[model samples]
Target: MTHKQKPVIGITSGDLNGIGLELIVKTFADARLLDICTPVIFANNKAVNFYRKTISESNFSFFHTREFEKINPKQVTIFNCWEEEVNITPGTLNETGGRYAVTSLEMAINALKEKKIDGLVTAPIHKTNVQSEQFSYTGHTPYLKASFNAKDVVMMMCAENMRVALVTEHVPISEVAKQITAEAILSKLAIIHSSLQQDFGISKPRIAVLGLNPHAGDEGLVGNEEQTIIAPAVKQARNRNILAFGPYSADAFFARGQYEKFDAVLAMYHDQGLIPFKSLAQGEGVNYTAGLEIVRTSPDHGVAFDIAGKGRADGGSFLQAVYTCADIIGQRAEYGEQRANPLRKVSPEVVSRLEDEKIEE
Candidate 1:
């Protein structure tokens, strides 16, 4: 692709003590990847070099640039967010690693706000270590939502075939029952529907919503959430012309492979959706934050401190995250173009004029 055609993807080096930089370096080692998009890594020189040398990937080189105008499309570039030297100890979690991780992420987000990057591909970050005075959020989805001031967002885990979205994320399992309300379900459905149409290029998306209770309440035998809250939400969504259905029993729905018939699935809580997504995605899935103005994706897995410096981390999911971000950018652009100026109906007089002109020719 040409420079103009290639999207500028900003990559954040997640927890320095984790496998964030390793995956970033490994994915960009392939020279052919530069042909698709320009990747700007948000990391200091010390952190980049530590991972490069530890991984023994000497062939991977990047240009240092503070300004986006100096970005080299034909090569990988590191945007220096910090210049100070920091200790790099793999498999260890500390406050410094979390602080630097937030620094890198904040810089990339600012660049995205300024239109310096087309999309963002964030690596894994330790949810606990990354919390501080400036950064205090459950995870990336909530943080990104608050950063962009978005009213609602969907934590959609997507793979090649299956796509699962969550209505409640990073919330306590005990509170899951109390949180399952008609208003919340309806809001998530709206976000999912709009995201499917604009971000995934689905004109009429068919959404499958999962039930909160076992057996979908077994018709009030086990619970009443399915009938009282979920059913009403589905009705409201349908009234808005959204192609939504279900209060389906989660287990039977996936066991019977019913998810294959829908464009997307909306689970009532995090584990209800993520357990199946991770199991089925098989390390090839991406966690995409839908309903944001800008596209953001991350590897479905978290910071694997166990394999941090062992050079044993797989780059498949991270690579897929980058590709997914690029794909969403392209999809949104195409969707916008189609929505901008739809095909106009031709009049009979214009049709006759065209016929007469063709006959004369």
Candidate 2:
């Protein structure tokens, strides 16, 4: 039997005009990354060269190949998804950018599905530009959920100190409340718990649930969603043996640094979780999609159109994303191996007989 010591990670060149390629080039400039995983960039040679030239200071280069078998483990490989030269106008928003971004993502996803790649690290895409008749989703999370036919998925933000999972992502504030049901919270909690244990190697995960209303509804005075909706969901989760607590006031929880006490925090909405996470992440946060059959991670930030081609884009989050993807791949393998064969429990009678036999011997 043989196993690959290094995982193959597929990187998508996000928008042609965005900082995605810059981040990719900057992150891989160290060359040490190839030691952990074989890097495959799903983009044309033109795009790769464009970014490489734009960031002239970077000495990073890639092995261009259209064939998967020719992928080099010791160097970066550019898997040409398209040969047509694209007009890459950095820091610009247009339909062309969106369309090309989708193309790159689709190619990477196909490779992931075929097991050609062990994990995926997607670059950020503009939610508006990427939308078309074929791709109508808001962002990567829902798109991935539908792509893999995943029953559910949570957009979990991971940083050095804390992990935060959103209950409702990319939804308007008014619609957020309507979507916050007991079932929704429980579903997210279950996914978060499983992800913590499986993807993160937490044996027993503790999840802190954030409240929807101010002061957690102030004990039903401010709002009752906390009492009627959230509290019940926590109880149901506990009944199912999940260590889920709170419906805690969001402001207080993060302000008091209570998130440090738990394995992960589940917020009622996007801003509730992300605002604090981005502030705390300090430019090194990775957005991981949990409950997927495959590993997918991206930089916590979006396509910084302002800093796209200026070579000022920070690669910290993207670098962390790569690390996180490889780590989860390894963790899942270890977790699977741990559960592959369980020790059979000995009966009390067998134990007593064994003890007696041992004494006689």
Candidate 3:
């Protein structure tokens, strides 16, 4: 499919005072990236212009639009939030910036739910500054679930050929034990499996499930979650004909490139998956919110408060987010074409898995 035929992605300007605006402004300035997908930014025109001028970016035009139905991808489209003007200072943090940042996200989410756009590409928002009473939940994943009536969601960071999904997210290190359950692991694996097939279009995507304890609990001597919780879940997923197996020692899994054998690796916790993911990915990775009714992705990095307003802030991750969304939209469109052809039929196993998931639900 051509870029124009691809889904229109709604880009959320995360925080006014942070690099969200700067990155969005700089990335969109590149007209060539438009070939991937047309982007609509949920942002303030004045704030965007103010930041662009500060950064000395003059190539892009921010076209303001009140009605989402009037979005034109050929131009830089803006959904007017139009809150009170704030100074576009580089490297500064304020509640005003935070409030405006989240407003953009909320607006974009509404547009996604209404099918105003195909996918959501969010810029980084300062977790501390951009949150308000109306916007609750620790971060975007939870926020997405609450807004869309989704039961469970996964956080997967993607860079090049590598994708990592976290089984336990945002929970404290101390509570990892209590939260680790066979059912939870099984459910997460199922979610990842479905996401890989439907969104990623991976046929029989292989998954490597990470062990909870170090060295897989040193063969159940040091810890037992590996044997007690993780192993059983892996077994159950296998029984369902899902190609999943693990509880591999986290240290060995990433070290030996064991992760390369699978489409995705299920990390036991946040840092367990993210440290390696970011180390390899850095500024180039995109954080994808999996299992949403609409596609959503953001830069893997968070709000760089220390360099909030600095022109030095990198736009690589944000650019990657946009490109990733574009690729997925293209892939989904390809699936549409395949479905249209009467000669190709979906395999029986694929159809059965879909039915089984619905029954489980």
| Least well predicted 10-residue stretch by lDDT in candidate 3 | 335-344
**RMSD, every candidate, angstroms:** 3.5, 3.6, 5.8
For model 1, the run of ten residues with the poorest summed lDDT: 337-346
Per-residue alpha-carbon lDDT of candidate 2 for residues 1-361, written as tens digits (9 for 90 to 100): 0123789999999988899999999999889998888899998888888888878679798889889999988999999988876898999999988998999899999998899999999998999989889999999989999999999999999999999999999989989999999999999999999999989989899999999999999989988999899999999999999999998999989999999999999999999999999999999999999999999999998899999988899899999999999999988887776677332245778877987999999
lDDT-based ranking: 2, 1, 3
Sort the candidates on TM-score, descending order. Answer: 2, 1, 3
| Deviation (Å) of 308 in candidate 3 | 2.5
lDDT of each: 0.90, 0.92, 0.82
Reference-based TM-score of each model? 0.94, 0.94, 0.91
lDDT tens digits, residues 1-361, model 1?
Answer: 2223889999999999999999998999898889788999999877888888877644788899788899989989999999878998899989888889999999999999999999999988999998888889998888999999999888999998889999899999999999888998888899999998988888899999999999999999999999999999999999999999999999999889899999999999989999988888899999999989999999999889999988889999999999999888888877776667453245778877887999999
Task: Report how far residue 37 has shifted in candidate 3, in Å.
Answer: 1.5
The TM-score measured for candidate 2 stands at 0.94
Candidate number that wins on lDDT, 1 or 3: 1
Candidate 2: where is the Cα deviation over 4 Å?
A: 1-4, 343-361
Candidate 3 Cα RMSD (Å):
5.8
